[model samples]
Target: MSATDEQNLIEVSGLVSHYGDRQVLNNISLDVRENEILVIMGASGSGKSTFLRHLLGLKAPSAGTVKLLGRDITTMTRRELFDLRKQIGVAFQGGALFSSLSLIENIELPLHEHTVLDKDTIQIMARMKLEMMNLLDHEHLMPSELSGGMLKRAGLARAVIMDPRLLFFDEPSSGLDPVTSAELDELIKQLRVALNMTIVIITHEMQSALNIADRVTVLHHGDQIFTGAVDELHASSDARILNMIHRRPSRHGVDSDYIDQLTR
Candidate 1:
């Protein structure tokens, strides 16, 4: 292994996954470098979310190993995985905040559950993260009261409250105006530098990926079709990659045998 390989915070090797009879992921392998933003890009039903679940050890892979901070998450005991998760954070696509809790309560929930820190310390830490995400003034609002951008920021504030070594964000620009999406993209880059955390973002937005990705891995129908810098992606001649990047509809044919079986 090269010195660069030694610096990888998360390493996924030949990962495969399935939901019942349907295979969802092929042999997907990736390494997330320390302090870098790696975007996972794909259209809907392209296995991006399934791949992220494998990374988080949310679903056990059918084969292969996923290593986070040098520990194999696929094989870890529930207790072990829970302990290790303290060093990792995730911000879901829709913020996933509890509607019943205020923003500050939601943000500080992790500290309350995982740490023995005093209430004052937890509150202070939550506020620090909120301030970092430019959300300090809106800490008292409920999830339903906040705008999409503000909710994303609040989710992010919670994700980083633990000061994790690695962060996973799902669709950071999913449903927002162009200017708000651009602002969120900038916030992601800023968080990477400010927190010194390795980030893996799951997004289908080409503009957002290009805006913030240090490198990107593109998935197509469970296959890892491309993984490289944004410029390389743009310069590629592969029709599959180009079609995805250009928002062209896929013209793939269906399997005749599968159709016959379904109709029979």
Candidate 2:
């Protein structure tokens, strides 16, 4: 990536989202550096997924700017938006592969939809990606035949098949065993190095975030509570940070005495 690209693959400022009168995200701003693994983390209702929707141009931000390669998407025309979004890839939380199609078919779906590549070349490219993810043999298998980890890998392979400069992952470790999750983390790091791709992951798995994030951004009540290196987060003295790291019960539902004892 060029120096300018390294500066900001994605930039969001004063971002907000609402469903009817219920505000989901509030005044959020963050930059995703090229080739950096940025982990966006928060509690269940902290707006992590909603923030991603804004970043991906799937939903309009209520009051903010979302820039891809420095072009604000909020005001962009449909053609411009489509052109800009072409440079990004998203791996959904559940893999979201077509249940009826084979793995290779699922991976090739994007290329077929977006590009003019010939059938033979697209097949070759799809196979290469499947092999890269160690799923070559399973390319003929349907989604129902794959394990949870394999399904995730297949989805990741499909995400990168288009060679997107920006990659988005939503809970890559959602339903896998610890060993499988760890292996997926290793694959993520490897892909980052190999493709020099900038990654933005939204997840609540502390271990996964700490293991792979170049930097971690924690959100609380729609505000950024912390942003720093993993080690800094581990060593920080901030109450919110400490509470999150140690899995402490929040005072939101607890009695005052319980909160006091917990804090003490």
On TM-score, the leading prediction is 1
Model 2's TM-score against the true structure: 0.92
lDDT of 1 by residue, 29-82 (tens): 989989989999999999999999999999999999999988899889999999
lDDT (C-alpha, whole model) for all candidates: 0.92, 0.90
Off by over 4 Å in 1: 1-5, 252-264
Model 2 Cα lDDT, one tens digit per residue, 1-264: 567645998888889899889898888888888789999998888889888888888898879999887789999998999988778888998899999999999999989999999999999999999989999998899999999899899989989999999999999988999999999999999999998899999999998999999999998877887888898899889887788888887866468887789999
The reply for model 2, stretches above 4 Å from the true place, is 1-6, 253-264
For candidate 1, give the lDDT of residue 261.
100
Residue pairs in collision within model 1: none
For lDDT, the strongest prediction is 1
Please state the error at residue 219 of candidate 1 in Å: 0.4
